[model samples]
Target: MSYGILSKLKLAWTELDNDQKEQLGPYLTFTDYREIWAMGIFLLGATALLPLLIVTIIHYQLIQTSVNSEFILRTERLTSNTRRVVTFFLDERLDALRFTVNEIPYNDLTASDRLSEILSNLKLGFGGLTDLSVIDHKGTQLAYAGPFKLKGKDYSRQPWFIANQKKDSYVSPIFKGYRNVPHIIIAVKSVRSDGTWFILRATLEIKKLMQTLSSYKTGRYADLFLIDRSGVLQTPSEFYGDIYQKLPLETPKYSSRTQAVMTTDAQERHIIMGYAFISAKTTDTPFVLIVVKQKDGMMGVWRRMQANIKWFVGFCILTVIIVITIACTNIVNRLYHADKAKAETMALMEQSCQLAAIGQLSAGVAHEINNPLALISQTAGYIKDLFVIKEQYRNDEELIENIDSIMEAVDRCGRITSQLLGFSRKFDIKTQNVNLKETIFDVLVFHQKEAQYRNLNLSVDVPEDIPDIETDQGKLQQILMNLVNNAFQAIDDGCSLDIHATREGSDFVNIVISDNGCGMPEENLDKIFEPFFTTKARGEGTGLGLPITYGLVKKLNGSISVKSKENEGTTFIVTLPVRIQKEKDGNENSIGG
Candidate 1:
């Protein structure tokens, strides 16, 4: 019987389709499932955070470079624009002086009125012009404007006079004026009507050029300033305080002459210098229009790039987090349910083995008790018949009392005989569609005599509307009979047993047998599924009852599980399929033998 239960348990376990099988597969143990979930969660979390971290770093670097680049470029442009405006102003002033030098006929001028009129017009045409002078071929100041009262001071020894002798126009390097004005001299050569060369020298103020460059600001990190060819500050500098302050003429010691942007500091403050020469506009003169912009001033561009990068990083992080969370949650949920099903299946398997062993033992006891019981009943009837014929014996109180004891013995024997026949018979089960509630009631009727014999209370708890299930009648009867008997044996006096039936899932009906009996310990529960395992005393049980019941349940394509608490009670739950196939898949093991 124990072997039968084990076999049936193995069969029922095997009969499960893919979904049920997966829920109880050996590999899907709780610990293994937990580990899988843990790994999934870890990977998911990493997926979310890693990309964000990477993007944030890259964004920072790119913004830093881009902002720095933009600042330097704009600063260089500002410097160039400043130089051009200054050059144009100087060129125009020189041209005006040249016109005066060429038109003021030294031969026709009887007085200084002609030169004065022309000088005033030239001064009015240019905003920052300080002085305009006309020098002859001999370097003599032919005419002068403003406070310079000289009419013929230079006689031809000045360097600018010498250069003007051969050039159409020229710009002198920045120089300080005798009158303490910061200026550059613009010279132009003119051919007088006498066929002799003359020079026009004009002094242009540097402040006006500085104001042109300072007018525009590039973001917060960009401030533009100019450096002259000699590396002197040509435009008003925030660091040096004035346009006249000279910077170190040589490039920084660490700087390489690559046209790339660089970081530097003016007066201890960091700046991004975009230095480029005005070679395109300046005609091969050792004059560079250097543009320098501060690094910190370009923060607006940097900040914008940084902001974009931050948003990108944030988006990536959010996306990863969502994806990982969903994946991990799904995996964990599946594993959790799978492990739960496996646990229930394992428990059912154990209980089934325990019942089968008890059934086998009980069947043997029932057989042994049957013949003696029949003889006792026949002998008691004969004694009663003799007593009836002998009126005197019937009237005797002692004899009547002995006869009553015999009759009582006969009645007990008959009941034991009936129990033996029922327990020993290997029923031929007839399968049909039967309501699970009706089946529970029928099983209770079969157990009524046994319940009366043991003085045990039995109760049935089944819902009225339980769906009909296809199962063998005899087999289900045998299963229930074995279970009730075992429940009676497990408990002492004053214990009650409850049998319940109900619809479970869509395709299964559930029956639960519960008893407030002496339950086994946890350790014994583990071994209860093994063949011949029993907690019953010697001569009381064979431990085959549950096993046989287990076998019958399996044959009907059902499952069973037992939950027991020591000193409390035990519950045996059975889940039977509604309609079992006649020919199950070959992979399913046989419940029989």
Candidate 2:
């Protein structure tokens, strides 16, 4: 059952008009219209985006390179200025300590009263001095003043003490010592003539050192701080960390001159940093001064430019896709129409040629054969008449039957010749009120004998409610006869044929003829109405019956369609208008040979 349905659908698809067929042609194969459309879009997209991608990459690299160069220059400058300020501060304090040690006697330095006076004088001159202390060669604090009491405190185990002993002077990183405030110590070691050593140490305020570094005036997002060789923060940074905290940045290789680098921070912010090692002339301990700035902030103008370029490129790609789609669709549609028109023109020309050749052949046959058929019919009638008059011959039943059979054959041939003549002859439009049921009956009657001989079941159902339609009687009869004859020829023994007729609308009637037979395949069904196209073997059919029927129906202003499957059956439907309107000239009959 499913196979039957599929065959029907296949037949219907093939029966579609030329325009519809052309529209659906591309879909009937592996390479469909949608695939073609997709391929076109892909090509256009690639073409449009290739240049955009290249330009975007080049622009991005250029922006990054230019920004990096600018960031390095700016950060390096800030680093240099901050280093200078920090170096100056440390030098001043060390120089002050050296002077104090050289000018004061060793015994006086050890005296608490004299050390207090010296501390007062140092604080008055340098506001950052937090405290002052005097230590002997044994790393013991003999005298101390300001914020901490140390009449006799041992400092031998301290890193600063060991460093100060080895070096003439040393500057330590800021730390919370006994005073519990962040401060750095600057210690100067002095030797007497007898090689007796003493040290003068002063704690400088961390806030004052930071203020000097910040005064350099960097960018808005820039930060400056000092880190030890181990990457530990010595000074407080607004964005990095507190003093004595570890810095996130890696420690740079020791360098006296400033060096800059670009990197991303933990927050994924792009940054440029410059660092310089601040080396004191009198000490070995070195501090790194770092200046950091945000890369995006430094290249804000370039970022805006990149964004604009991206938007422009996106717009171009979209525009190209739309334009290419429209253009491709237009081109394909135009080609489809042109090809359809060409096919229709070719079909019409071929039909014209077929009709011309058939007409000439029909005329010749009718002229040459009609006379002999008439003569044979007349002679056979005369033979029957003579046999009836002669008693002896009339009594011979076998001879009488033979003469009657000859007369019948002669009449059949005459009818066939007349039909051929009528088919070839063209006539002006003629209309008469037609009894569709009676006409169908007449055509069916000719095929009834053959149907019975083959043991075929034939049925006809014309509704009583159907009204008579006005059409060309001869053409209508021919149409019905051809269709009925074809139906009878299609079936074998025990098959069924059905004829149905009804009024379709106020202006038209429909007749359907169906048969259970060895039906045609889909390919043959498509060409069933074309001139001289047939499934019958050579010599069995002229292949002109259906074409002539088709022409006659067209002359009466009607349409015909057929559906068939390979093994199921065949059905032909004829739709005719109730009436064909006469032309303005109103000639009842005209002749064309």
Candidate 3:
């Protein structure tokens, strides 16, 4: 690829500037980056928090609706349940009244004292009952209970008496008696089971109805009462303290729907109401079963939910602050390092150009020296040959040794020239799929003599499954040779060379060269990959080895990481891909170890 295109591709794929990488140690891991990204999205979207918070709210409403429905249903059932129990109790009391009157037979119970005994028996039979009375069809009150003399009072004009004239049996809605004790009268109009009209009536105090409706505790705000078809209160209400008094009804027409929900205008309260249409199975009068549940009583659940939302919002704010602080810190640190690295890199590039010029000069000197050295070696060889022919002089050991010394100097000069040529030339990288393990082995073979001279135990452990990696074979060999030479140079005679090859995940092969050599401190580690940055003394070392290795690794689209502890050991991990995967089929492919 052209330099311009390559630069663009690098910029697209890389997250930070080259300068930053040299400055900051390294970016955070992939996992940490992902977490920060998710938190950012959440914080950004927090503006519409409440509408999307439906998951926390809908359940409460659903449960409240279910309970309200159930309470209304249960209350209706209670109405029927209460009526059945009360009816039976009233029936027994009425039967006793029948017995008392029937036993008198129009002659034996003419006395007022005897009549009072009958009334007392009726009162004792029923609880919470006040006065009792018997009313004839002529509307005359015949016999009665309590201190009021109700014997000759006519009630034919009353609705209860008028309603009985058309029906065989009936119960009146609540009304005021002559003495004004709140009461209702249940009358049995006997007609010989053939629809004839002879009626009997008994009055019950309104307090009894209150006692029945009061059985429910409908929260603190709820109140229960019975309303007649005329919108008159049949039982005493907590709000009004009235019986048989008209309430301001929302509707004038009687309804049979049996249930309703409405807001009372007088109190401005939302109420859930349940009503039952009266059946002949209970009473002749069309009474209603009414149950009330106040909406104000349900504020507890709402208040608690409000408190929970407060805590949730607070937690979100705290989380956002933490994430933003972390993000800003990381970004600032990266920028600082990048700027530092850029400055250092510009300086280093200048140094490299100067060094390259010096290398060119050295190569020219080596070439000039090599030609003279070759001539000297040839002359020395000819002298040795001449001496071999002169037997007498050949026996002179001093002359033979001197000639050998001259040849040895020529040989040493030739080796030095070769080393200079190798270091100075710029060879084009020949890329191919080279087995990394095999390349390492080649380097080891070339350095076998030096390793032996140092009496070093060299070991190799390459993974059997390692893939053949794409790289310049010669460049890799040179890099490995430099590293191995450095390793040998670092160690004493008894120390060993440890080499291992393994796959690093799916996309890379890792070759680790570790040694228990005299390691450097952290101060030197930072400059270890810089050109000419050496830890060795003036005559012993050139600092180009690691920098060359680093450059070669980068050229192969790979990386090198090092870890070391002073006096303990040092490891150089070289990572390379198994194949040079081109971007194809609209996807990036990574192939490796």
Candidate 4:
């Protein structure tokens, strides 16, 4: 968001190769870059999270299916086991009736007192027996015993009696018969040698049958009840309804083996229902053993596990986002600093090219001015010669003096042009042996007049022991000229300027230029050697003088430093090697772009 943060973002962009720029040109703004970052996150997130989501979905389905199957299987198993128990109980009661009809005589069964005694003994031995009855082939209730009293009751129209006539043995579903209480009956047919037949019937308590089914444990929110084929609940149900209530669930098709299925109940609770059909041997009405269990109870662990998986996936996404943001920030920061450095380097190269162009133009202008100055000096010298040779001009001292002054002015102009030529001629280093003291005087030539006019005291202190350095003559001269010029301009009338040169050990020389003038602030010292950095008033300085001077020193295997304090004085120190080492020189090809 801040300029300082994305400052070099554009700079780095500019450095891209041409081919890369053509392809990446769409990314031209900060917003575009940010969009790219967001898109990158999206792509990476999809690559990571898509798989996770797919796996979670697959895993969820598998777990649901497995739990569903397991619950259903359990329901069916419970129903089947309970059905066996109920069937076995019915078989025992039927066997007892069959045994009584075969062993007891028709006369004994027809007597109420005799049948009552048999019923009491049967209850004591087998249990759940409520009463006994005798019926001749004519379907008349000839006798009865125990509990309810009935004598000579005819039952030819009853469904159980009619069904019993066809089967040797029969068992009926639980129902309220003549006594109007829930009970079941078993009938056995007896055939005598005279081709006569009789039926021995026994009544069993329905409570004992219910107890047998209810005793088995089902699961939570589960119930075991009997339902007839007509969808009527024959026994009490916990959630469906009481006995004889029309159940909401459809009656299952009769199957000897157990069947399990998942369904929703009246309350919209999911339930797993398992059922087994019990076929009545005598009556057409059949009953089903039904087991109901809530599905929620069976899959509690799966629900908890699903919740945990969601949390884990959510956490993983958050971590990925955090990691992406941090990595992008770090990469962008590094790119910013690197591109900032490159941008600074490019500016320096541009400055060098500009300096070289100015140097070329100066050389052209100086050469053009030299021809006129040479002609003027030649004409002035000829006039002075004529004045001396001819008698009429020889006495005219004023004319002679004017001619001499004209030649002097021409010479001064020539010297100015020569300084320009010397500065412009250098595109590369040219080394020469030179006298240090004389070289300083040559630089001072253009400034000596100003020094005198300003009444400034100038001191040159060069030790004789200091040897002439082997280096580029033009570069060394320019270095001296710029420093001396700056020193002169910084001072006022009567200020003392000092140039002190000394030998630095055996290999180097030191040129110290000191001026007691208005020096710059301490902070400006570091930037003084940077191109276009200056403390001077706007138009007076291009700010390249000292920077150029510093660069020249570096090219000549030398170093430069400056010390300055505001309102005090400034000193420039230039250290040069006594001999230039060209074979080891590396600055020649490093000047500019």
Backbone atom clashes (below 3 Å) for every candidate: 28, 0, 3, 0
TM-score of each: 0.59, 0.60, 0.43, 0.64
Write candidate 4's Cα lDDT for 7-65 as tens digits. 53333433557654453344332324455555766777788778988988898899889
Model 2, which residues run further than 4 Å from truth?
Answer: 1-19, 22-31, 99-121, 142-147, 216-220, 248-257, 262-273, 294-303, 346-593
Q: After superposition, how far is residue 125 of candidate 2 from its true place, in Å?
A: 3.8
| CA deviation > 4 Å runs, candidate 1 | 1-26, 29-83, 106-118, 124-168, 189-200, 205-226, 238-240, 248-287, 290-309, 335-481, 484-488, 491-517, 537-543, 558-592
lDDT against true structure, model 4: 0.78
Give the top-scoring candidate (TM-score).
4
Assess candidate 4 and give its TM-score to the true structure.
0.64
Q: Candidate 3, which ten residues in sequence have the lowest lDDT sum?
A: 584-593
User: How should the candidates be ordered by lDDT, best one leading?
Assistant: 2, 4, 3, 1
Tens digits of per-residue lDDT, candidate 3, 1-593, equal: 46643443232114655654554323322324335444554564464445545654676567667766665666556555555544554555556545655555433333456656766766676765555555655777666565676777888898878887776566766667676666677776554334423444667776665776687545565566777776777776676447667765453345544545545535777655555545444344545555555655755775686678768866866776555545544554454446546656665555455545545765787889988888899999998999888887878889989999889867766765665555466554456889877888988998788788888889999888998887778877877887788788778887888999999888888889998888779778878976557778753445656765665565566778888888877888888777654432121111100
| Ranked candidates (TM-score, high to low) | 4, 2, 1, 3
What TM-score does candidate 1 reach? 0.59
lDDT of 2 by residue, 170-273 (tens): 99877677768888888999998998888898888888888888887566888888888998998888888988889987778987689899888878898888
